[model samples]
Target: MTIATLFAAVVRAKPITGFIVEDDPDRPQLARSIGLLHLTMMGVGATIGTGIFVALTTAVPEAGPAVTLSFVIAGITAALTALCYAELASAVPVAGSSYSYAYATLGELPAFLIGACLLLEYGVSCSAIAVGWGQYLNELLAITTGWHIPDALARPPGNGGVVNLPAILLIGMCLILLLRGAKESATANTVLVFAKLAVLALFVGIAIAHFSAANFHPFAPKGMVGIGTAASSIFFSYIGIDAVSTAGEEVENPRRNLPLAIILSLLIVTAAYILVSIAAIGAQPWTAFAGQEAGLAVILHNLTGAAWPAVLLALGAMASIFSVTLVVLYGQTRILYAMSRDGLLPKLFQRVDGRRGVPRQNSYIVAAGVALLAAVFPLDVLVNLTSMGTLIAFAAVSIGVILLRRSRPDLPRGYRVPLFPILPIVSAGFCAYLIVGLPADTYALFAVWIAAACVIYFGYSIHRSALA
Candidate 1:
């Protein structure tokens, strides 16, 4: 068949309506045992890791004390995009997230592209979190024993290290848990989420005691351009807020819970981030924060003149990174499950391990790929790529909300974005602005990624799609 014919068939076969149908015949049935609290915790689990642990150090020096302002900017962007996501989650209430949203409103081609972007967004983000986890693990070890894993083993080769063994190991452990089942993964995630919060709270409290106004003297040292750039980087931290929306099909009373989880989680994370940024800046000059690895641990060591606080922060980082990996990995598997069910990918990915009620084969494939990337790739590059994909997906969702309003006015939307076209339009514009602010290298990478995705869809996805 011609490429156009194949694409059209795929689009027709799995029309957006397929997502709204109550039961999907080809997909495995997931238990709706997760409640609002669990979902909220999941958001916390996914979001609290890299932004606070690693990105803050990178951001503080760039924006100085104005890094707090960057957090607000990132939060606003996340909140706006989340509002659009809330409506879509409630409207579709499916597992595929933006992929499902695109399927419902745009068409199969757009849905395929969204799915491809999400693959990079979720899978690579997991790797990035694992790398961050390794840094913390090394800090914890050094604090406890006065020794660390060799620098070569602790970092990726490109970063002047022989290998990132800890990152790969962490990803492996999370993979096993994910293969076990969703409920188990969620429970584990909930515990880690609380641990991360507790440690961060402790950091905030202790760091406050060392507060020095001198650090705030040159607040915006890098100026407005620096603030904007840092905001773009910190924006990656908010990527996980949408994990709530991905759980829509499994959420109880999605209409209420989906929006609640997304908004409430955003608020909680943003508040914690702002407080942490303020505390960190207050504790030391912004220049000291530059290029500082294991930032929280360093702060603790400086504050108490003891290794205990650093140890605790390190332990927390380990748990935080673990939880982040689990949730992001879970998201990647489910999105692939959705695609496979729609016949856009190998049917093997749709196979649910009946005992675990999870997509076992898909988990293995994703785990292998993510683990490889975690071991060999530089963390910064992976993070920026993830941010780029997410920004595009967020922008698409915002536009989708506006398009759906006009095209399917009669459809019952559980939650509507406030102010309709205006809200979604603003949300789209904000995401686009962030995208533009990304470095030229990021744009180059994104272009290549999208081009590869389009090629894959035309060559394989279109012809094999269930709709075709």
Candidate 2:
């Protein structure tokens, strides 16, 4: 093909009007049972899990007592993206999440690319959450029964151990719960969110009792570079702030409820994360954070010289991480199901069980993929992969908000971002900066994933797409 022809083919945009018009009669319809309350709980459920509970072991060592500042930086970046997400979710109100927004605003190629990135955001996140669950589950067992899973079976292969059985089992259990249906899943998630918040509140209440000023002496021991690096790593904790947007189709009165839930969920999650970080650092010196598998539980055990408090924290981690895995896994399946219906993926993914009103086959496929990664890979590798995918998706959504405003000025929007182009510009810029902060090896892996996605699209999906 000539250069002109190739460039024209690649940059051509999908029609805004046609893409937004629903046409497929056989397309699976999700039950629209979620309210503002359920949506808010889901966002909280997805956000508060493994990221805070398991990530500190690495983040604290990087920034010392300044880890609190790292949380602030990450929260700002996430808030920017959340604003963009809210505006788009209110306008689009669809099932495919950001992928659907990109199709309506950007084009087919961009939508396909963003869909590829979401595989990492949700799939790898489930793996990371499951790994954390394994660590906390073992800790809880040891504290109460004086016995734990053998290290050889508890840790992943990359951690110099055999397959992580507990992580695999955790994914399997979530898969079963998901197959039961969405309403049941949402109810379970709501309960889990409250239980998680209560446990963290308990931890803060107890830890502050033993707060020490000595831990704050050299707060930024590693300097600004360390804080930036820690903030980039800590960004993983905020991944689920967009979970509310993913359920736009199911959310009641989506226009108003979607944006409200997104904003409210962010505020609640940010406060919880900041309070936990402060209490943790105050309770114990930051230098001792490194290499501790279950950092929070270890801190409580060391502080009180008692097993009960640590066991309580461990129980909370297990419940919280399990909920995270369930919600993230659900997000992955729904995104793929949307793609399948659009003829961009195999149709098998689009099939939903008529009676159960759930995508049963899709759940099984996601479960197997998530369980394999959780069973073999180390936590750090899964975490960086998840963060990279989310940062890219966030940048795309910010850009989409700008494009849609220009292309469809006549469209009605229930929620408009406060500072039109500036918020999106800053959101996209910070997302790019965080992506750059990731290790070179991670960038290489991301490049490979994108290239693979391109090959798949050009070889099969492009010709088969419903748009074609």
Candidate 3:
């Protein structure tokens, strides 16, 4: 068949309603066991990492105390897109998240592209966070003792070091947990989430003692451009807010809980981010945050004049990064599984391990690839690329909400976006503005990635797609 014919067939494929998966229907049964609390914890597990712990340190120095305002900007952008996600997620109530929503509303080609963009967003972000964890762990160890891991073991090449052994090891550990099953992985995530939160609370509490109003004197020192730039970069920290939407198919009372989880998670996380940023800035001069690793640890050391708090923050960061890796990796595998079930990719990706009720092979494949990237690549490059991919996907989902509302008004939606066209329009505009704010090279790289994805869709995905 011609490519156009294949694309049309893929687009016309019947929507698979409910949790039934024909090829591996057993997977849905495996998934249904996950409940609302576990799903919310998954959001907590993923949302609390890198952004608050690391990104704040990086962004605050650039935006100054107004980094608090950047957090607000980023939160608003995420909240708007998240609302659109809630409506689509509730209406579709499917396994794939945005990919599924795009397929149901846009077309198969769009779905494939969305899936590809998500690969960059989730998979690459996992790698980035893992690398960030490595840096903090090394710093934590060095602080406790005068000695540190050799550059060869803890740092990537060309940064005056070799492979990041700790990062690779962390990714591998998360992979094993994920292969065992989602419930087991979620349990571990819950524990880590609480530990991380407790440590952050300690930081906030202690830092308050050192807070000086003097820090507020030059709050907007960087001006509007600085705040906007930092907000765009820090936007990566808010990426996990959509973790709730991804679990829509598995969520109980998704119509109620999905919207609740999305909004609640965003609110809690945003509040935490703003509080943490303010605390960190207030405790130390904003200029000191620049180029700092394990920044929370450094702040603790400066505040208490003791090593204990820094050590605690480092330990918390280690656990937080591991949880982030597991959740994001899990998300990537599930998205791929959804695409495979749709026949947009090879069926091998959709296969589930009957005993574990997980997509074992796919999980392994994703983990291996991400681990390598984490071990070898520089994190700064990976994070910016992740932000680019995420911006495009977020923009698409926001626009997808509008298109669906127009085309499928009769479709049952559990949660409607508060303001139909206006909210979605604003969401899309916000995402677009963030996308434009990224460095020129990031935009070029994103273009190349999307173009490559289109080529794959036409050359392979379109022809092999189940619908075709």
Q: Which candidate is the best by lDDT?
A: 2
lDDT of every model, 2 decimals: 0.84, 0.86, 0.80
What's model 1's TM-score? Answer: 0.96
Write candidate 1's Cα lDDT for 253-334 as tens digits: 8777887788888888999999999999999888898878899889989889998888889898889888888888888888
Candidate rank order under TM-score = 2, 1, 3
**Runs with alpha carbons beyond 4 Å of true place in candidate 2:** 1-9, 12-20, 23-27
Inter-residue clash pairs, candidate 1: 13-467, 16-104
Q: Provide backbone clash counts, one per model.
A: 2, 0, 0
Clashing pairs in 2: none
lDDT of 2 by residue, 1-468 (tens): 577855554455656555356545575577778888888888889999876799999999999999899899888999999999988888888777888888777778788899999888888888988989989998998889989999789989878679999999999988889998887888899898999898899889889999998998799999988898888887877877656777766678988998889889999999999999999999999988898888888888988999988988999988899888888888888899878877899988988887777889999999999999999999888888888989988999999999989988777788888898999999999998888778877788889999999999888887778776
Candidate 2 has an lDDT of 0.86
Which candidate has the top score in TM-score? 2
What does the lDDT come to for candidate 3?
Answer: 0.80
Candidate 2 is scored at a TM of: 0.97
TM-scores, one per candidate: 0.96, 0.97, 0.94
> What ranges in model 3 sit over 4 Å off?
1-30
